[model samples]
Target: MQVTHAELVTSAVSPNQYPQDEIIEIALAGRSNVGKSSFINKMINRKGLARTSGQPGKTQTLNFYNINHQFRFVDVPGYGYARVAKTQRASWGKMIEKYLSQRENLQLVFLLMDFRHPPTELDIAMKEFVEELDIPYGIILTKSDKIKKSQWTRHLSLFKKDLDLPSVDALFPFSAESGEGSDLIWEIISDMIEA
Candidate 1:
């Protein structure tokens, strides 16, 4: 997609704070340190737009980025960060769950996972939770450049087996640093939005 304009529209902690326009929304969910901010920056073709950080769990709210003024990319808080207090984590979970279950304009969810390792328990649970909610979602395996090309098939197989990915769902291996899989990811997103 040609991103003529992209900017952070809001950082919302509650549904009332979300944009009230009729635009569609695409959400990104993953574990902490899964490079979600980097993914957002890369996809939008802008550096520092999503604020990549060294610290895990830095994104505490649902960051809404208006893309070309046509749709919004909602960066939900990352899960599975151990340093955060239990109460805080529980609150985050409830907030995320409520948004996922109740949002009507949410068209798709891109569930990010680390390509260098097997899917974590949180990742599996997230996949199941979204499916149970009847949310249309896909998996994006990030940091593909960190692994060898020959191992891609093995990693993909492991993900499918462990996650029990639905046949209708799609999975893409992505590398924010190398720009790999960016075009394909965009095509998928565009198709969903247009459909």
Candidate 2:
């Protein structure tokens, strides 16, 4: 979709604070430092729209960005940060679970993963959770420019084969630095909104 306008609407920690609109929401999910913020910034063609931090696990809230005022890009908090406390992590888990399982406006989830490696245990577990919840989602292979193309293909195949999610499209290689795959990602988002 042509991004005529994109702006941060709110940072929500609870469902009660989510935007009170039925607009379709496309959520971005990934581990800490997996380029989720970069992806959103690139997709919206707006620098600093999503905060990019050198420190992992800094995004501790559900960031909502209204796109064209038609739909929303929900940036879910990154998981599996080593420095985070166990109790904090558990709370994060519950928050994410509640949003994913019960959010009626959520239409699609873009699950980001590293391109150089196969899906990590956390990635696989998240995928399984989404499947069990019957949430529609797609895989996004972030930091593609960091890995060789051949290795990306191998890891992508491994992810699909191991997850038994062959019906879902192959990994979408993206690099916010290069703006690669930004258009394709936007196309997918538009399609979802239309559907």
Candidate 3:
């Protein structure tokens, strides 16, 4: 879908505070610095639309972006950052869990992962959460440019085999730098929005 106008609508701390609209929501889930923010910015063709940070755990809230003035891209705070206090991290965890579990408008989730590494523990946990909710989701392997082309097949194979997920079209190799797989992402997203 061509996003003619994407704007930051609100930053919500609770589901009750979310925009009171019926528009569908697509969530970006992943660990800190797994490129969730960068992925959103790239997909929407907006620089800094979803603030990218060199520092892990920089995004600490549920950021809501309205796209085409029609739907929403909900950026959940990245998990697995070690610098924050344990209690604070736990709070963030609860917040994300609540959002995912309670938000009725949430349609699809894009689980972001680094192409250079396997899915982390937090990634696994997020998958479990979505599965529990029976939520439709897709895997986005960001920073594909960091890895060689020949390694892509092997890495994806491992990801599917190890994750033991359902049929693997959900997994995609993406790169904000090269725009690899971005179109495919949009197609999947289009299908999701229509569904």
Candidate 4:
């Protein structure tokens, strides 16, 4: 899990643009402004590598980040930003669905959700979509530092019920600011890669 080398490999809009080296890919998916960039930065133990932004829907491509020359972290475009044009949103949706469904090397997806609120409609839809695709995935409750320790159980229970998350799947409470749950997250990723 020691990340000796981590760098952005490419910003790809299609399958032809993706890295062709046969590297395993783990994707990050979430709503716009849900801290997907921060999750990648925290995972790689680097700041500004994934480009955290105040603007929603900033990532328009599948960003491939090479990790330890072993696998890649693919940062998919964030969804549910109202300001984007309808055609553009449709394009993004198509691109995301294509990549998730067709990519052979894609090992797993980390579905990030804000810990402060209930799972949005888009979040539930995404969960169902991934399930229908039969893709291995985990639910990451981000911004856990903003919540109280006593409320963690209640929040987790609510998320599980709302998302209809299976009991066997992984769920981690994370904080990019505090580095909480980073190790456990890495453990899960490492296990997936090794398996």
Candidate 5:
């Protein structure tokens, strides 16, 4: 992933607002503070390309990023924030569900989860939703740098057990700050793009 050109193409709220292109789309989804923006920044080798915020639930729309014009990285609104209004949350749910279930160009989804803790109830629900939609997905365990390297396998295995993962290959540890797992993630994305 030699990202020479990476820029935000659009911030969309609905399918009509989405980019009208046939390019393959790989979506990034996770909890409100799962560090998705940081992962994007590390993947594109840019600082602050996708805004990172200390505040949770800052991303309120689906942000599309064109990566060297090869494929689009669609970042949907983060979920599971407590302070967000219920009505706003409902709208986000509809927005995300519509995109995930209906988008034709969407190829794969990368579900980010914080590695420091077990999956929350909302996390389980999102995973189940994606599964029910029958969409291909990968699990990215974020912030692995906080955990000891020796414990990663154990942690990942626990996640596998908790999520009832179809395959261990479908998931991996990630550390956006240290750029860990970026290559593997890129490899997965590239495979999907080429497929």
Candidate 6:
């Protein structure tokens, strides 16, 4: 997808606050600082449109980005940050669950995981939750540039084993710095939207 126009349509927290349209949506879910923002910027060829931050949990609301007015990319709040207050985390979890389980227009979710490490407890829980809800999802091994090329296979296997995934077909290796896997990701997204 050659994205010529992209805009942040809205930053919503509740269902009533979401954009009232029938456009399909794809969501990005991951732990804090797992490169969700970077993934979005890379996918659309925008540098700072999604606001990358070093701090974890910077995204507090559901950010809706209208991609060429075709579909919306929802950036959900990152989870598993210990610095966040329990009450705040609870609310964010509820917000995430509501959007994931109830949003009718949602088509797919890209589960972003740090390529350096295996899936964490929260990541496992998230995977299980989405599977339980029967939401179609794809795994993105983010920050691939941070690790050596030789270690890519090892890390991928670790994630696969930890997540109990039978094969590597569902995983995508993404690197925001090198633009790796951007085209393939876009291809998948384009096909999903078209379907």
TM-scores for every candidate against the unseen true structure: 0.97, 0.94, 0.96, 0.97, 0.97, 0.98
For model 6, residues 10-50, the per-residue Cα lDDT tens digits are 99999999999899999999999899999999888899899
The per-model lDDT (C-alpha) reads 0.92, 0.87, 0.88, 0.92, 0.91, 0.93
Better of 1 and 5 by lDDT: 1
lDDT of 4: 0.92
The true-versus-predicted C-alpha distance at residue 67 of model 3, in Å, is: 0.6
Candidate 1's C-alpha runs over 4 A off are 166-169
Stretches of candidate 5 exceeding 4 Å from the true structure: none
Candidate 3: TM-score? 0.96
List the candidate 4 regions with Cα displacement exceeding 4 Å. Answer: none
RMSD of 4: 1.0
lDDT of 3 at 86: 98
Question: What would the per-residue lDDT of candidate 1 be over residues 1-195, giving only the tens digit for each residue?
Answer: 888899999999999999998899999999999999999999988999999889898999999999998889999999999999999999999999999999998989999999999999999999999999988888999999999999888888889889986542477999999889999988988897788
> lDDT tens digits, residues 1-195, model 2?
668888999998998999997988988899998999899888878889888999999989999999898898899989999999999999999999999999999988889998777778899999899989888888898888887776766776777787677644746889988988888887887778777
Worst 10 residues of 6 by lDDT: 151-160
lDDT of each residue in 1-195, candidate 4, tens digit only = 899999999999999998887899998999999999999999888998999989999999999999999899999999999999999999999999999999999989889999999999999999899999999889899999999999988998889889876652467899999999999998988898888
Clashes of 1: 0
In TM-score terms, candidate 6 sits at: 0.98
User: 1-195, model 5: which lDDT tens digit per residue?
Assistant: 788899999999988999998989999999999999998998898999999999999999999999989999999999989899999999999999999999999988899999989888888888899999888888899999999999888888888888988667877788988988989988988887787
Candidate 2 accuracy as TM-score: 0.94
lDDT of candidate 5 at residue 75, scale 0 to 100: 90
Please give, for residues 31-147, the per-residue lDDT of candidate 3 as tens digits: 898998888888888998888888999888899999987679999988899998999899999999898988889999988889899888778878888999999888999999999
- State in Å the error of residue 93, model 3: 1.0
Worst 10 residues of 1 by lDDT: 164-173
**lDDT value for candidate 6?**
0.93
